[model samples]
Target: MIRLVKVSKSYGDTIAVRQLSLVVNQGEVCVLIGPSGCGKTTTLRMVNRLIEPTAGRIFINGKEISRVKPEQLRRSIGYAIQSVGLFPHMTVADNIAVVPELLHWAKSRVAHRIDELLRLVGLDPLEYASKYPNQLSGGEAQRIGVARALAANPPILLMDEPFGAVDPLTREKLQAQFLRIQQELKKTVLLVTHDLDEAIRLADRIAIMASGRLVQHATPEEILSRPTNKFVHDFVGTDRALKRLSRIGVASFIRPTHSVKLSTPMKEVASVCERCHWVWVVDDDGKFTGWLDRTSLPAANSVRQAMVVGDRDEITITKNATLREALSRMLGQGFNSIPVVDEEGRLIGEVSLGDVEAATAKMEP
Candidate 1:
């Protein structure tokens, strides 16, 4: 939905961006990544005329941006940045309602959009709507910034290090939320980041820029497995194979495994054998609860009495989770396999370290 042809931005003698040409297709995220002075952010700003390009044509869905009014062009495109840029004086709902209200949407419609966008970003409208930006934590502000950008339901989104300001744990969560939101909303995105992990995790295509010019533009898989040049190779690093594993989902490797309901008699749990010395334990509704260590029989009636319970987030992974995450969890917990769950935490299957190993073996260069 965004097309830049030979785009160049210069300030006096120094050119911030030089003849950079790229295309971010409809409904896919295109990440612009490179080193500190590589002009990835400059490239993003040029898309919405935040920093006008000195040379080259910029287009949003085939209409040249230079031909459109700056305010109109920007309003039609969503913009998010590292600092979050939330207005401290404005309440969360009012902040999100900015663009929609600017468009003259009905007051009632604007209010509904506020709640809807807040929820979409995983925030409660009731608790957060009346809050000011100063009341929000860094992560909350980042989420609010995203909600505001998406407030108008723009087809194109420009994000400049959207998750860069947060801590690692919070960054991971924000990335996951962004992925889920993108899956549902399907907005075309052009994001700028220096993080290779973030690029691999989110980009459908990675446009690696250097010295204000496009160095390589390709799918993350191809970029990792086959670098176009020495610069691209070094930029991707020696752990290219490992990085590729992050792109594979846990669902692809899930295997059917034995499981028992929490209500099952301990005697029955002790008899059923998966040969792993443990059986997955779930509730009556089939939601994953814990595990039954068949190796140690307990003097109890039901599986719930004998089984070891675990934190849902800590012990189980969702179908969409990357194998890299699963592998990390397994190594951290010293387990060979991890349970895979659905959105409702229902046990689907398990993915083993062997599965992760087999996948990584092929990626070795």
Candidate 2:
């Protein structure tokens, strides 16, 4: 956990950061985002003591970070930057092992950590371990920078536009990978980025800064659904509603439905059909197969035989997928119902058009 209390920074005549106070809970990703010249970067730097605050106090896990020696405090926290400042001459493994080596970890332990971190960030230790930073792609270099920050397994991570140097596709991949890693590791993260979409996609709580002051601090949904002021609303832009959808999931819209397994006979399928337009056909493993037309089932012997064997291209979303993803799939395929599945591909439930519409309606101003 990290906290900043009425913190401010000034460079002689200019104020780089205003009286900013904020908290980043343990295992939460708090993103700082705003236009250039805003204090987001300054606020982040103050936390690591890279830029000492001229006023107020900062604490980490209840201990004032300023009380600790700057080097010691920094060693306890992981830090990454946009340029990926990897040593050009050092091997990937060596680059990642810098912090652990500084802490005087055993050679064997450092080696093991390097291997683990490389794999954790989707890089092959055996292949990349011996390569220099120049030999890697921008995305790979960014991942290495992240792996280096994480080498010591610190509980707190500070990232400043860590993926900004990569191409859009690579940036997306790294963002997704970082998010997945955060989900598993759950480190307290303070990330600074100028990209609003990035902030919405990755932040557990986003702090929007402006003119050296925090304008808003709220969850992505709350920020989008309920902007604190005109500045906040304008900053989120006209696509705020669409961005809100990107954060919601199909699971939030799914409701209990009369579903039948593949083994269910045609008669049983017909019986449970009720007024529903179609029956969902699922395999023995409970994975969705296709849909069965109720009208056509009367002439068939079994549900499987009656089921439309067409490409199950019908929108299928995982439990972790967002409502916007489901909506995108539906609009792309022109389908009204989308089958929801678990990680193992087992059918869970179906989300309908009415469900999505209702959810969107509830989010309206």
Question: Which candidate achieves the best TM-score against the true structure?
Answer: 1
**lDDT digits (tens) for residues 1-365 of candidate 2:** 99999999999988988899999999999999988998877888888888899999999999998889999998879999999999999999999999999999999999999999999999888899999999999899999999999999999999999999878657866887898999999999999998887898899999999989999999998999899999999999997777887777666677666567779966678778866878667789887777777888768888767787534434567766667767777787677877887767667887877777777787867
After superposing all C-alphas onto the true structure, candidate 2 shows an RMSD in angstroms of 4.7
**What TM-score do all the candidates reach, one by one?**
0.93, 0.78
- Look at candidate 2 and tell me the lDDT of residue 55: 98
lDDT of 1 at 33: 93
Q: How would you encode candidate 1's per-residue C-alpha lDDT over 1-365 as one tens digit per residue?
A: 89999999999998889999899999999999999988988888888888888899998899999999889998889999999998889999999998998899999999999999989999999999999999999999999999999999999999999999889878888999999999998999999887899999999999999999999999999999999999999999997777998899887798998899977766567678435688888999889888877655656677767788977888899888998899888998888999999999999999999999999887747
lDDT values, one for every candidate = 0.90, 0.86
In model 1, state the lDDT of residue 34. 91
